[model samples]
Target: MTTGTARTVKVLVADDHPVVLDGVTLALQRTSWLDVVGYARTGRDAIAAAARLQPDIVLLDLRMPDMLGPETTAGLLAGTPSLKVILFTAYPDHAAVEAALAAGAHGVVVKDVERADLVDAIRKVVNGERGVTAGIETDAGAVTARHGLGGRGITRREYDILRRVAMGQTNPEIADALGLTRNTVKTYLQRLMEKLGARNRVEALARAHELGLL
Candidate 1:
């Protein structure tokens, strides 16, 4: 998914609705930095198009005909670990967000997102950062608490790190902010994940928020 330094970012858009697919594809193409490489109307088509197009980023719809968001994301990453995926959905439920992130999706964006925000999400994920759309953290907190998954306490430092993560800081960015080495920050993230029983930063931060640790 790495492009030449001079090349525009290539993107593949997948949505079940034709209007959505066309609109998003056109929106992305309007940006000078982004190039729309392909479009898919189903999860099966998404996986196949991704394998063939090998785009820098994939804007995937959460609910699709064949495979769901997580399954499609997993398939894409399985074929190319370097590819970035940002799940898109109008529903925006906590379980869907959690599942998508757990399946290795780089981010999640609500379908109603502004064009600029959507573009930002694509850019962020391609840069190895995670995108958590509006209302997700709040929803996650509610879901985590409702499921009784928020009783555990995390260390102060872990709480600090998770807060930074919720603020959308990447590992290296967090390391610099906290004056820690990047590897140490990585280790902390691993420990934090284990402590929170989270598969990714989004889940860890959300769970921590639900526990009132952040």
Candidate 2:
């Protein structure tokens, strides 16, 4: 229940996959207070739509045929300074999640989440809360990187995996070092990908290398 402003949250859904976009749009529409203002099949389209629609939030998919994740996110922010962007993906990995938050995304969402929870997250952002996924818990006090960028704080465990991930650690190797089951390591990597706004682990690693984070 919302107060008198009708308080409709306008959103743009950006994803290259038609099935995912359609499913998300349908799910979002089920929330009475939210509206789909536009749709984008690529990152460039997303940025342009955000500028034109000036929507309150953008549900962005990290991998697009035309533009990559971080670059697309930067473009969206540059175009619509007031817009809140959420990286929506099926995969979630710590490094990826950390990268997205670092790249200026307000938060990240796993497309695999229950629909109601996803709707709740959308509302949270509309109400001016940082709707970071419970899975991407960010702590700003953990890193000693240059510039001492507190906002780039990812969990220590995640940081460790990112290093191994950089050195090309296999899932089994990562599991051994992190004391995690192979399946657990995979889940964490998927979470990281979502956080980093990366469509896949390869993409996430590539972006990390480019940012000199590796």
Candidate 3:
């Protein structure tokens, strides 16, 4: 499934399970725009293959030998700043997923996600969209505690807006991207700033980074 031009998207898939690796690779290979360049069974191997292959995107499993999704995501991004990562998990562990997101994962998708949704998510993420989660329920309390947020915790909406702000998106752009009114975006931004004890967008992002919520 593709739109517009015929540009090919090189992809590297990393999964410990051979069955899963093969299934995902074959499925993605069926898509005209996606090229499955390589596969890895461990986080370290994924990192190595990503560096060697230089794929545009990495479909990484949430649990792998040597390292978890968040750690691997951080390592991959540190090595290849231009690579997009999508965390693929059988279980929707909110804390872990939030950590991966904070570590700069482009999106998270359940293992059972529909092919169409997965394709859409990759496309959206490649288009610079953040917080692309599919078939996973986010727990605000779990994410708050994971990042050491006490007494005050941000809601899902606030977190979404915060990520967009960190990406340097304007309020109007955020509103359009999230399908929300500008006033609603403003309200969420205000609440996020208060929760982070920041006076402005820049300060809020700084505080969020200090708190490990970004």
Candidate 4:
């Protein structure tokens, strides 16, 4: 929550899909602590609305017309540094989610998330906690238990690199995308492979799939 007095958390919902936009707006409006302030169909519209409405949080869709969630998140944060963003997506792609988080999103929730879970996540984020998937583990211990990684869990950065590898991106491309040097990317890749007990990228990806990391 922002400093000062306690008050309703104003939210702006942005989604290209009309059904989802309306449904989410209505659902959020039912919460006494949250007020749905506005709606937007495109990322540009979202940015404009956030500026005009000065909402406390923006429930942004992952894939919007004109801009992606992470880009929109960056724009919103640049304009209003105090505003929080929670990404709403049907596809929880590890790379995309990590990219959005890196862009300053407070949390990521799946589209099919239960109303209670969504509300809890929103409240948690507003209360200064990192939001996570509804039924997924966000901590290292839980991740290790779920993935059976022998007490070693894959990190966000490693998962990002792993996802890129699964997408068939070259190391240089991954480095450029992540703003890392080629050598740094190589080092991270090597470390991730070792964690996965794989000899190369192909084997690493296979191991990741077996562990449901990909």
TM-score of each: 0.62, 0.62, 0.64, 0.63
lDDT of 4 by residue, 1-214 (tens): 2223378899999999999988898788777788999999998899999999999989989777665666688889998889999888775643345567778998878788778788887888788877455544473234434443334566667766776687678999999988999999999999999998999988997987776555
Model 4 stretches astray by more than 4 angstroms: 1-6, 135-214
The per-residue C-alpha lDDT of model 3 at residue 98 equals 66
User: What range of 10 consecutive residues in model 1 has the weakest lDDT sum?
Assistant: 140-149
Backbone clash count for every predicted candidate, in the order shown: 0, 12, 0, 0
Candidate 2 TM-score, C-alpha based: 0.62
Stretches off by above 4 angstroms in model 2 are 1-5, 134-214
Cα lDDT of model 4 overall?
0.78
lDDT of 3 by residue, 1-214 (tens): 5644578888999999999988888778778898899999998899999999999899999767666677789889988889999988875554346667778898888889888778887887777878787776664226436544334578767876776686678999999978999999999999989888999998997987776554
lDDT (Cα, tens digit) per residue for candidate 1, span 1-214:
2322466888889998999988898788778889999999887788889899999898888767765666688888988777888888775653345556767887777778788888877776766676455425454335534443234545546655665676568989999978999998888889889988889888886876565443
Residues 15-103 of candidate 2: C-alpha lDDT, one tens digit per residue: 98999978988998887888999999987889889989999989888666664455577789989889988878654442344555666
Residue 101 error, candidate 3, Å: 0.7
- Highest-scoring model, TM-score: 3
Backbone clash total for model 2 is: 12
